[model samples]
Target: MWTKRYSEILLMTFMSITCTRAESEFELRDVTLHIIPANTVERNSELNLTCEVNVVSRGGNTPDLKISIFKNYNNHNPVYINNTRSNKVTYTIAKAQASHSGIYQCDVSAGNQHLYSSEENINVTGLQTPELRVDKLKVTEGEKVRVTCSAREESGVLEYTFKNGLKVIYKESSSSGVVQRFHSLTSTETAKFSCSYSIHVGNGVLHSSVSNEVHVVVEELKFTAKITILPSTEVIEGDSVYITCDVEGINKNSSVLSLSKGSRLLPRNYSTVVLANDSGVYECRAKVNSAERNAYKNLTVKELFSTPVLTITPAEVFEKESFNVTCRSSKIASERIGHDDVKYFIYRSNKMISSDNGIYKTMAKNETNGNYTCTAQVNNTIKWSQWITFTAKVLVSKPTITVLNEVILNKPFRIECRSDRGSLPISYTLKQNHTTLSHVQVSNPSQKAVFTTSIQSIQQISEFKCEAQNNGVNSAQTSDTLRAQVTVPVGKPNLITVPVEQDITENQQLQFLCGIPEGASSPITFKWYKEKNLSPVYVTTVNFTNAEYTILSVEGSHSGSFYCAALNKAGKEEVSNHVNVSVRMARWKKGLITGVCLMLVTGIVFAFVIRYRAMRVKVASSNGAGIWSVRPPVLDSSEVVDVDEPEEPNVEYTEVLHPQNSDPARVPLRKGTDTVYSEVQSTSPEFHDEF
Candidate 1:
């Protein structure tokens, strides 16, 4: 097992290296296959096939080119040893037979590419006939003779078939260890035996002509041997019986007599318990010199009950089908026991599936597939039937297909195909428009196969489907057809106006339509932009056929180059051709502007006229001050108008002063402390003095 795993690892590594270089970088050509000696060889001879290749090495020791040899059209795989790193490799077939003939070819692996070679035919003709022989030309009765059948010149694996008068009695492969066989004769008669051999060659078998026949004769010796049973030849099992042997027609002192029961030598008079197995031919042998004589008699011991057999109704049972199994004994010795005394039971593997009633019937299921055995019991004599295996074949169920995402044009998308129920080794095929895209065989029923494909055109997306088949490819169950339309890439968008005009006035409703060449299966997202701004002013997702961006009132802000972009499941953006839009004012707006200008001029003139009148109403004053008042303004005092100025203080000469009116403390000390000061009178009588 370890060796097998190591070989696998090596193979994987070699393949990895072989694929390291790009296919175009590989330089390989001129692979030729040659046959040695001649195109044809006789049987039991040697034939050689050589494959030669030419490869351009990549600036190193000769690139270790790998070569694979093949026979017929199975060129994808090598005949043996898979790949070998030899420029020229020879395949030798020793002891060649007709089975080894075929058209041969070779494949060369260099760098990363593979090259095919021309074909050559190798033919192996003729077969060696076998020889048959016997050790004795004549043998006494009840004696076994050694028979040898061989093909001395034939060396390879051959099948030896020994025949008795055109009827094959024994056949075995040459690889089997048995070389010589024994032929036993019970009655005095003449018999002929012959042999032939067959060899397996390229997809078929080749048989040689029958060999020459050898004849042998059996006769009774001069002194005969005899055997007798005391009770009877036929008896019930477990009954004791006596057997005796006697010799005649020779001196008793000279001839030796003995009894044998199937290779076991017994006394001249033998006694033992008779059993069902002991019911066979017993022999008595007498030997003198270089000759032996034998006599045989058949004994019959009845079995208490025969082995039970388990039978099925339908040999080939499939899942969910009804089937039955039962246990029954074909023979029950009525003399020993009645049929009702026996009981029957059935089992699956080691677990009993049926009770004493014997019959086990049910609808076959996947779990019911196993080995079944049956038994019959008569008290303690239980007999079992040989085991028989039953396996159910489950039909493939209808499959369902699902896509991983949406199918995009020119992009690989994954599609999963699955069958809910089926037997192992179910084959799945993916098809587009009835053309097979890919196929795979799944060993696990629960496993699903994934295939990658892309839609290059609209026609390629029509009707993709999956086929599930367990019986054969020709007979397959189909899944519900998946009709997938490709998510077409957003084509160059075409932006247009409602009236298809170049200019429009403000306050006028405008409609801008953003559309693609064709609709996509998935919703298309549209973006509308004006001028050279990187951001779109209006964005929406809808079918491109009916997508539009509308403006309730076309304004100066909307008066720029208008364009739109469209995006779909294709994951790409496409922009439309720019359409310039100009917005201008209406003629009615000019009159309204003129009227507002007249009102502004009248108001300014009126304000200026009022200011001039006010300036005229003002009066001048000497001090630079005055405006007109409600009453007349008073005159400035230049001379004494009302009363004469008070005369200068006459008392200035001797004005008396009140000393009690003056205080020395400036803060006027109070709080129950009286303090006073005298003051001198001033001559300014115009100013009254108060303390």
Candidate 2:
């Protein structure tokens, strides 16, 4: 035991200074001293000790540095005998005596700094091994064992120790001891009793030696029961585990073997089969005629699961149709559904779905059309299968189209295309007069697609149609054409006569020019209304067509509140504000009218303009604002006018050339063109100027 402890101390010292002395982490100025014969040696033996000094530069000696050696590491009062001074030096002691055993160190001085080396122990032993003897060679259990040790001469401290293998059973420390008494020797085998002595000399060194071993026998009965299992691997459910109990130093016939769990007795055998519920502390008992012993072993059980197979019924599915997916597991079917059983779960697109009986029956929706799988979980154990893809096909029907608003020439309107039954991402194509107008793709399967478009002319009845197609690659289904009519809507019309007054003379060339806003469909029919009645006037001499009502002459019967209504093929009509016409005198008194008469006519125009502005303001205030609004303007021919409202705030109008008419007889009148009839034209196609 002392030898082991000394080796451990040497190991700890070596670990503390494993690195070179120059590379020490703690900024200590020191030297490393290594002494030969680290432990005790016999007296009169040669020994050599070396001191290697590592110095910090403080302008002291370099190559020949001053280093002093001391005995017992006492630097305050140095010992002059066998002392030397040098950068590196080794001291040799030939035939060392007991007085030479002490700790040694080296020191170096630089200006006001001093460096010290670690102390090294040098032990010179003069003691001899003691003689050990026992009173008897054998002893019974509970008997006092006596061992005696003696040294040839008086030793400092004598230690007597008795050991069985590496375990110390008895020990005693005394000065010059002679005997050691051990009580109740119960060791199962023969033990060796040894004696040794450790004495510290006057120079701080301990000399020690071990005596010859004296073997003593201890008589005692030690019975043991050890259990062993055949298969060491973890035992799962439904597995048969074999357990064996071995009894030491007992004959099979003399000893009775029995197995037990808690208080219940099992089959009496050296080996037994372990059950699933038998997972607990099990004891194996060996009973002889007078002695009995038992040993315990722990048993545990684990659970496992089998893979699940997923199946689908009526594998093919249609849009808005129902389908079923069944996940069957033979393991689950064999095992009863207890609190510890695994529950089945179905997944579509990595999202869990409800299936009470492992049979997932659900309708085919957009969200439910993806790859599916299933998983089972019991406690912390879970297992899932690979994904199975499922795609649904939907039946497409013919698309029906209708105009959401009145479609006019050069006027924006919307045409809606709808499919009654189809999947999402359906494409819609709008055609006018057998030509493609716009193509729209509707992402939502349930919504209709609206396309805004306009017509250029109403020379012939325009035919429009819409078609829908599903986004399928193989034999993609398309819808039939839903035909519609593209007719222009009449804009708000303004009635303008030759004379801007209500009072007019007879026999004068009085013409009613219904100034329609530009971009109105051609061949518009006009109806002239009179005084307080909604019914139109029927005159035999006048013909009203092409937005113009020509009377060719004025009469007293026309003096009333006259308003006009314009209609086109769009099935919508627009009525103009009424103008009061008062025929007070014949043509002879027309020149004799006063300023008040002129003022009366002016007041009527003022009142009409004021009322129109009020209506526009009311419409803008009610809703945030609308696309069409007009303010009373200072009329001038040179100033550019605007009637068409911009949809966005950042947009400004720029002119583009309009396509010329193909018919020569119905050519539009321009300022440069001389035609048989006089026509008033506006610069912008959407805004018309009043005459």
> Which pairs of residues collide in model 2?
408-488, 408-489, 502-582
**Over 4 Å off in model 2, which ranges?**
1-233, 237-305, 309-391, 431-439, 445-447, 458-463, 471-482, 489-691
TM value for model 1 = 0.34
TM-score per candidate, chains pooled = 0.34, 0.27
Residue range with the least summed lDDT across 10 consecutive positions in model 1? 647-656
For residues 1-691, could you state the per-residue lDDT of candidate 1 as single tens digits? Answer: 9999999999999988878663435367688888887889887777777888776655533566777778877866667433555678888877776656777888777656778888888778897777788898888765778878777666558888887776677877874323577877655667688888887766778888888898888785577788998699998755788999888887867778899888888899999876577788889987764356789998998877777889987876667789999888888788778878889889897998887878889988978989999888876556789899988878889998888778888889888888887777789999987889899889965566889888787676657899999876644899877766577787888999975886888788899998777646558889999888999999998854548888988877778898999887789888999999998776577667777876776666567645743443322223212212122335766322222354231111112233344333232212223232212333343223431
Candidate 1's displacement at residue 137, Å, is 91
Residue range 1-691, candidate 2, lDDT tens digits = 9999999999988876775443432223567877776546777677777677665443453443456668865777654323233456776777665556677787765444567787777777676567877888887544566777776454345555655456666667676546566545554567777766655555454535777887778676455676665575356544557777668875777667777778887764434333345567778887654356788888774444555677766766666778889775555423434534657789888887854356788887677778889976655546676679987756556777777875556667787878777666677887766687788888865566898876576542246677777745442444344444555566777887777665677766665666566655456777777776867773221222335566667777767777788877766777888877766566355655666697887788678756844553222123222113333455786334233433232221112222333223322322223222212222443333221
Q: Using alpha carbons, what is the TM-score of model 2?
A: 0.27
Number of clashing pairs, model 2? 3
* Poorly placed runs, candidate 1 (over 4 Å): 1-371, 374-391, 401-404, 473-475, 478-481, 498-503, 519-525, 532-535, 540-546, 568-571, 585-691
